[model samples]
Target: MAKSDTDIPAGARRRLLALAQERGASLAGLSELLGRNPSYLQQFIRKGSPRKLEEGDRRTLARFFGVDEGELAEAREKSYGATPPLGAGWVEVPRLDIGASAGPGALPAGEGAFDAFRFSRRWLAEHGLEGARLSAITVEGDSMEPLLNDGDEILVDCTERPFRDGIHVVRLGESLMVKRVASAGGGRLSLLSQNLAYPPVSVDVADVDIIGRVVWKGGRI
Candidate 1:
């Protein structure tokens, strides 16, 4: 039997369609990415065949899209009678009005919360990031292009930890920058950039201040 549009959650359908269009992804390509038949997503979105996405399929789509799984799930209309409040199974992470330079360096200016983004508590816990001090900052410059782009929002885990190899927000003198920090040996660290145009910089560990580790990043498609 064919399902009607009413049978499918409007929010999920619209969100998926918008993301697909923004990313320039065809329904057939997305279906193949999900390991499904070529017409799977087309049927779901156009014909409303499934009514709602399956749990596994939704999870995969959420990860691929760099969004919370709840975003892809059917919004609970009865819970709030509209959009749910941030307090409802969601954690408010502040978006700092500062840009962490991906190029040379950007001075840390206006370190205030200009806005906030809400994430599912369940999603945070699943990622082993529960109870971690999290904040968001914009990425600046093209040095980290192809990975972290200019204007991209990155979720930073501010929980202090011993230096390990990973992308992190570092402070050198008065400038704050985001780079892939790896041990250069002899008590020095190498700040690497994604773009080959920018060469890796080696500096003494004591000269750099680790602000936070970049856990996740999101950018416009």
Candidate 2:
């Protein structure tokens, strides 16, 4: 029989709690980890009530556990027998002024470097991009408009490598640019821009530095 959304067995909840603990996450921390209200999460765990977790939410948790979504779902289903004691181990991540998102090469100015914001370790563990590391920066110009608007918060994975396709932030000489990468052969590549007003630029592979690959974009509605 298909279980109702609210009918998720007790085992599943316990396992979830355990899993969060194992991943160094606490209930209070998980709420903050996901940028959710702490009281809401407390109620959620205390009541064993169900909430529809979106794909992004699932992805966030899956990433935190270092497991895939399918695996997480299966674990939940299999572990639905008992409520385990609440275990806790969630930490917070602080936001740091790493750089300014003007094109790409614009580094942070005075009081920018070493500045940090608080974030949940649980959230970072789950949603951290693969290969590419997370680096927070505020968007600046309109050259990469529509897709990336000014003042939008972005997570860049610096550890990621650049492929011929997809948008990327690159540094060429003194200028940094956010554009599409296209292989031009002979150790060269072309940087393309979406905005018609901006002209595309070509360069040698040696001169270009891939600062990071933008995996997700966060903005105010």
Whole-model Cα lDDT of every candidate shown, in order? 0.81, 0.56
Tens digits of per-residue lDDT, candidate 1, 1-221, equal 76554564578787888788888889898899889999999888876677768667887888888887667766431111121236758988878878999999998656667678888989988987877778888999999999999999999887757768999998887788999999989999999999999999999997887778999999999
Residue 135 of model 1 has an lDDT of 83
Candidate 1, residue 193: Cα displacement in angstroms equals 0.4
TM-scores, one per candidate: 0.61, 0.48
Clash totals for all candidate models: 0, 15
Collision pairs in model 1: none
The lDDT, on a scale of 0 to 1, for candidate 1 is 0.81
Candidate 2 regions with alpha-carbon error over 4 angstroms: 1-132, 160-164
